[model samples]
Target chain A: MIPFEHIMILSAAIFLLGLIGLFVRKDALTLLVCMGLLIMAVGVLWIAVAKSFGEMLGQGVVLAIIATAFVQGCVGVMLILKLQVHKPSLQVKQFTELKG
Target chain B: MRVELFYLIAILCLFFSLGAVFSTKVVTSLFCFLGCVLTVTLLFVLLQASAIAVIYMLLFCLLVSIYWVTAIVFLPKPNKNAYSKHFLHVGVFLLLGGWLLFVLLPFLQVPAFSPAEIDHGFGSARHLVNVLFGPLRHLWYALLALILAFLISVPVLIRDNTKCGDLS
Candidate 1:
């Protein structure tokens, strides 16, 4: 059987993968998707830590997470709308037009 | 043993997290992320934090997914070429994984700190609400204020000046 620590390590691994994707992908939308993965990985880490302690009440953290996700959604919508203003393409390379 | 159950849920969370990260399709990745959150929420339940788990599932998994999908629907599909060109990223992932394993192996070999154990009373939502309203209430109100500011700023930020019906 896999140990809890092993499972946490696996989540970390997955998060690292997402991080790499976030750094390497130049496409803004793909970066957002990778960021979402990173967020999911962190949530798994939170759950693992909570379970390890044997205490309950992840409410505050959950609430905070939902709020952060909402903020991210807002930012994403704004970015897409901004993209509509400057360029039709979602590629970060094309964003060079905004460069000073 | 309870440890075994904890490990099972942890593995489920990890697998779904990995799926969420590595899946190329954005929608599929979101689904996998939802699975990951659900597993984590179950882990929270096992920890006796039913309130947190339920909130996480309801808000993060269900509601946030809807918000993200709706947001993405407005954007064009991402370019395929740049994403597929990231071969070096795989090497970076492996290196990071190895470094993490090296750092964690020693710590994992030891037993967890006893003081870190979950408190018994932590499962009660009544206590949580009471505590939040007592000391943390200000923080909650601050968050609300921040959201209000964000709502007010959206129109000023996204107004279409050109009226060309999207720059595309």
Candidate 2:
């Protein structure tokens, strides 16, 4: 078995990568993708700690989170498509007029 | 041996995740995102969360379908200036963020606490179904209803907006 700390470190690294991607990417689709990665990283972290404690709730939470992520991705894509239909662009800068 | 494989999968997951974030073309980035999800699913399998692994694999199929639809419908033009403009800033953030996570690593470490008689079948689908429909049944049903509502309302919202010329 791998040391528990190693898995924690890997999960942390993935979480950070997702955070960076969220910050750097301006496209809505890319942002949605990063959000999914972030959610996955959190699920991994939950599983790791839950395994250490010998509990099943973490896995259950992970399953729920994945389902929620699926719904979120679908809604996000639909909103993006609606935006594209109106504006014909997917760039974040193009939508800045609504920032106020 | 399994530990080594876990490490290999972790590295691949990180590499593909970075590729997904940094790729210039949208399609390439989407493909890399799929790769990252697949690698993470493999990690779940290695961790013995077979049900979550299978669920993620199914979710990955759904994601790929969404990717294809977005690719055909949106067809975003590549942002040529994104890399050159944001590379330095993101690199600095990553360096500092990584250092912070490394420093916090010791605090996050949990002592090995595996029970003597661990339930090896904890993450099986049967176990999951029992848990969801047992103690967590109400919450699960509520979430399902919410998701269904959202699914039904989104298209209606879009159509209404289009009809009202709000989106035009």
Candidate 3:
């Protein structure tokens, strides 16, 4: 039987992966994916906490996660489009064109 | 029964999120992202947050999916020469993995079921709202306003300026 703590730990690991990607990656889209990872970790935490509380609040937590994910997805797509058009590539270094 | 199913769904979500992150192609990323969103919505359902779950499925999945498709369709594709080398990426991955393992090892050793029990009453949305609006009200409003400002400014700042780029 999988323990609830196991699930939380796994989520935390996934979150760390995303964090590594966010900090180490040079691509704009990859960073966005990392952001998604961070949000996913929070979603998992909220769900787990809701279940443990036995408050039937899982739905509320999920709703919030979905809402947040939608917003992130919209912004991610727009950023990728803008990056591709301006830099002709996805690498973050190319975006340095805006630098002083 | 439900817990096992939730774990399975969570694993699937992780897979799609990986796909979304690792794919070099633009359209593939969008599809993977869609998968990730749907998986999380299911997770929301498992947790019993129905109202939030519906909004997530409709507003997040449907609405954002359309916008993502539109954005990718209009965006220019880069030359294949832009791809990064593989060995450097592998090294970075290994280093990050090592660091993460070190950090998580201590935390993972402790059991989650500690002495304190989670209070069901104060965990609801009502309590959350009260806590946010009562003591944390100004901070919350400030954050919303800042996000709004960012939404308004980012497009103007990051507009396509490269004439040599593809037309898509």
Question: Which has the greatest lDDT?
Answer: 2
Which tens-of-lDDT digit does each residue in B1-168 have in candidate 2?
567778888999999888888787666677678778778876776676767877887886577568546755665346434443443444366458546743663353322112211124666677767777899888878989999999999998777634545664
Worst lDDT run of 10 residues, candidate 3 chain B, spans: B110-119
Please give, for residues B109-144, the per-residue lDDT of candidate 3 as tens digits. Answer: 222211121112333345445544676678778989
lDDT string, candidate 1, B114-165, tens digits: 1122223454456457656767778889989999999999898798466556
Task: For candidate 1, write residues A1-100 as lDDT tens digits.
Answer: 2256765785687688779877766656556656766766676566556556643334556556656865685687567666756666556787766553
Each model's TM-score? 0.58, 0.72, 0.56
Minimum summed lDDT over a 10-residue window in model 1 chain B is located at B110-119
TM-score winner: 2
TM-score of chain B of 3: 0.44
Tell me the number of clashing residue pairs for each predicted model. 4, 0, 7
> After superposition, which runs of candidate 1 have C-alpha atoms over 4 Å from their true positions?
A1-11, A43-62, A85-90, B62-121, B137-168
**What interface RMSD do all candidates show, one decimal each?**
4.1, 1.2, 4.6
TM-score of 3: 0.56
> For residues A45-86, could you state the per-residue lDDT of candidate 2 as single tens digits?
888877778777889889878889999999888878877766
Candidate 1 chain A minimal-lDDT segment of 10 residues: A54-63
